[model samples]
Target chain A: MSQLNAAARAPLDSRAKMIEFHEVHKYYGDYHALRGISATIREGEFFSLLGPSGCGKTTLLRTIAGFEDISSGAVLIDGKDMSDVAPNKRPTNMVFQSYAIFPHLTVGENVGFGLRRDPRSKAEKAKAVEEALEMVGLKGYGARAAHALSGGQRQRVALARALILKPKVLLLDEPLSALDKKIREQMQVELIKLQREVGITFVLVTHDQEEALVMSDRIAVMFEGEIAQLADPETLYRRPNSRRVADFIGVMNFLPAQILGEAAGHVQLEVGGLGRFEVTEEQASARASGAEPVVGFRPETLTILYEGQQAHDREAPATIDEVVYYGDMTYYDVKLDGVDAPVRISMRNVFGRPVLDVGTRTRVAWSAGALVLFR
Target chain B: MKFSSLKGYAFLYLVFLYAPIVLLPVFAFNSGTIIAFPLKGFTLDWFRDLFANQTLGLALKNSLIIAVSTSILSTTLGVFAARASTRFKFPGKTGVMGLIMLPLVLPEIIIASSLLVVLLAVGMPLSLFTVILGHTLMATPYAIAVLNAAFSSLDRSLEEAAYDLGETKWSTFRLIILPLVTPGIISSALMSFTISLDEFIVAFSLAGKETTLPIYIFSQLRFPKQIPMIMALGTCLVVASIVLLATAEYFRRRGLAKTGAKDTGGFL
Candidate 1:
């Protein structure tokens, strides 16, 4: 399906969209961990809090979980004030980063553990446990001890335990972090599948941008203690609203950008070092961005030449600084003098031919449409 | 496994500490009631006489009640202390923790006398109630020590996960936290019980009309003929101490094993 069609048909189900934090501040006695966080989480949507470590992403998640109360401002969940709601009383469940499976309990016990007073009949509880285990692909493993499971197995167990409770929303705090790379990829796919099947709101906190992009329906890019941008992963990656968001999500070449002209349709930007680039509203509304913009172009969109003079308007002459071969594509870190940072261009081997070498002077070329100018 | 020779050091360690406890039952059966090396005919007279002595039995009953009360109360306090110290960041946290642990280093005599003076000044009479209060205060730090091991080493993410799973703070602690830290709680309770049982200075100073076993043993030291009976009682106490200490150690070791922590340093 086309991106437009998918977005046009996107449904915001009864996702606990009831989360709101109004001017909330958290202080660890002078060290302001969360300066002033104001955010609303829509229920049923898979929203990911993405940032580097110590960006207060986990703190945000904990605050939502009621583990850490906001020092100031009121937080509401499901339209009820959550300033005094304890973690246990909240209608949310979390899959922790370490996959905090109860070490002393077996898989079955861990899954049904939260349902202490859940008046589910024995058969119903067993059925739920079995279905949850099966959903995570650990059907028969319910009898296995939590300690005996491998990291991935343990992660699945943690997921099943939380999922079985079927809370209004599920909070995943880097739940797949403990698994090996291969298993992490596999589990990421499984997690996305499970999130869809369960149809519960999921708020995932992760420092890993790749993982966030891979799993989240919408991503909230956090910096320090505030959300820099909240948009779909593609929007977040393609045209990050801020220079900080652009630098965070993926590799981008930032050149000093100025508005040459702004009309009702498109905005003309004079990007220093890389020359002029035009951005249209059909790409992403520039008004939501800024007036004076910082022009950025994704590395993968740029084509690096071995040796050539570009005759096109969207060409930047630069010397190939570094070359990184990543199996499917080769990344050329091109350095154009007078630019603030090195211009990165990733070229895939379409016809089994290699591109520019390191230290080799080359011209990087891309479409005027490919370059994104953000204010 | 390569530290096989460390087993020898362990053996020596046990013998050095418990050789006396091993001799208690041996001397308990001595017909002479005297604990000398020369072979004495085996007799159950000391134990029979101990049962027959109404005051001694009363002392035994009093000590049991005090220790049990101290264990239950101190361990309860320890649960809160352990949870607070592990889970939250409070003001003056370190200083407060140091103060709690101060009793561990302070001499028992000082604690006893100071407590005695304070209680008297407040018009509280010396009795089993006062003894329980003092013993609980003294045993609390050890309870904290044991429970802290369990609480600190616990997987905190588990608790976070519980909260995310729609569990209230109280429910999570009741259903999940307590179960995970059960071994530590048990170990703490046992350690407190034995510490109170074997404690003397505070109990002696506080026992007005009520004498605990340790105070009774101390009083019997005044008479010459009572020496043998003291040994018999000493023998019994040695056995009790070893049992209590061993059980506490067992639970502690089990708690550590549950958390997958290395046995770096432990109670002998």
Candidate 2:
């Protein structure tokens, strides 16, 4: 996983910008849909706009496809201003959330829809359509009726139809949202592989944070018509800039903290359950959300030490409040001796270790380096 | 042997509706010129006389022209109205659509009289053209009603997909929207044609000398000798209507099959 992250991040500085949004604002009557969205998508990068519903992520994506016009500011595609370009004239294609397969046409006709104006011969276009279908793993399924396919097959056809154009950018609006859990997960991996294979700039809009993290090279987390944070997946997961972003991304346990001192790019903090510790300024977010300062950590970062185990970092004495077990991992909600509320700790279930019961006494091993202080 | 009250009511209602139509064919083929039948022998005389009548032929031609023109004009207007109402939002949209669909409930006599007054005030001479104008005004609301269902059920993204695939707005409508809504268009056109063909108040109020089929039929009702021939004409009209409706239903089912859409109980 770390190797894949390194490879995805290695060529960031040398890539050209494929899409640029410069202070774009969109309004529908009285409601502001996108508030001054400014971002640059690198060439061949798999980017994602992730947010909850009504967060303007889909609206931002439609701007790139020219399906929507901004109320002010500009959008540039491949270094050219796209103010006057129609959707058909723009160098982009979109896979709509509905899949938008033409029910009246066969899969082959739907895949070759964009080639109607191409100067290529009929035979060449047919070959291109077949090749596009094969790329989406629907090689000999061209003659099938579009409306007769299942949900997953329809999505594959939609992907083939959009990719056949070979546009500079491909926009997907919640493409896998309608599939079942198993199919959705399968498509996520397939989409990542397909993006790498095509090497096109893919801008995906999804409400699923896990989907975004798994597929995107970089993600822009949006909330209420504005981007809250934009960074790569690892940075987004490890170092969220705000409490809202942290809460939205994944499970994070918060413990009340007090600031003691700051010097030399390090900050001293007194935490509620884990007692006193210091964190680097990079680990602390300076943005204040008008709440009490809290130090947060992921559930996996806190390990419940078993009998005869040694602690590598600081140790906290706690009592198990609740126990929930999966086949592969066990979660323990433990209350530290000094804290009122229990914080969750996740431990991987090894082959020989037995799962602990509720109300058992335990010691939690944690490190200050894995904690993020949010104010 | 145990019939429900509701079933009996339905059976009686159907008989009440169809018995008059059944009698038209029965009397049309009867040999006697008298309306009352007591085992009258079958004959082709009334049908032969119906074909030889020149005045009836002229009225039929006039009605055909008026109905054809009204159907085309009203359906074209309905397409624009339905598309605009379903796809786009503008100021006072509800009020605009309400006004367009208002004529569906308004009495035809009121529309015919008001249209006659306006056309005469403008010194537009009354003819089959005037009748067609009045019939189109009456039929457009029904056409819009049928077409609104078609346009509203279409996915908006389908048009966007076509546009994104490099087709212009016109081509997208021609290739995608038009073909998809064709069943609705045919339904609307047939409805308009039937309305204009059978309309009496508007044709009587607007047509100065040009007599349509309904006006001629009404005029012939006074002469007792022409009653049998009128029954023959009514029989032919009923047969034509049945054939037209069956053809329309066939096309509608074929369209649904081609697109794999569910059959939601279309017009029979």
Candidate whose lDDT is highest? 2
Q: What does candidate 1's lDDT look like per residue over B45-133, in tens digits?
A: 87877778888899999999999999999999999999999988988999999999889999999999999999999999889999999
Per-residue error (Å), model 1, residue B92: 5.4
TM-score of chain A considered alone, across all candidate predictions: 0.86, 0.97
The collision pairs in model 2 are none
Q: Indicate the DockQ of the complex predicted as candidate 1.
A: 0.49
Q: Could you tell me which 10 consecutive residues in candidate 2 chain A have the lowest summed lDDT?
A: A1-10
How much is the lDDT of residue A54 in candidate 1? 88
Cα error of candidate 1 at position B88, Å: 4.5
- C-alpha RMSD by candidate, in order: 4.6, 1.6
Give the TM-score comparing model 2 with the true structure, all chains together.
0.97
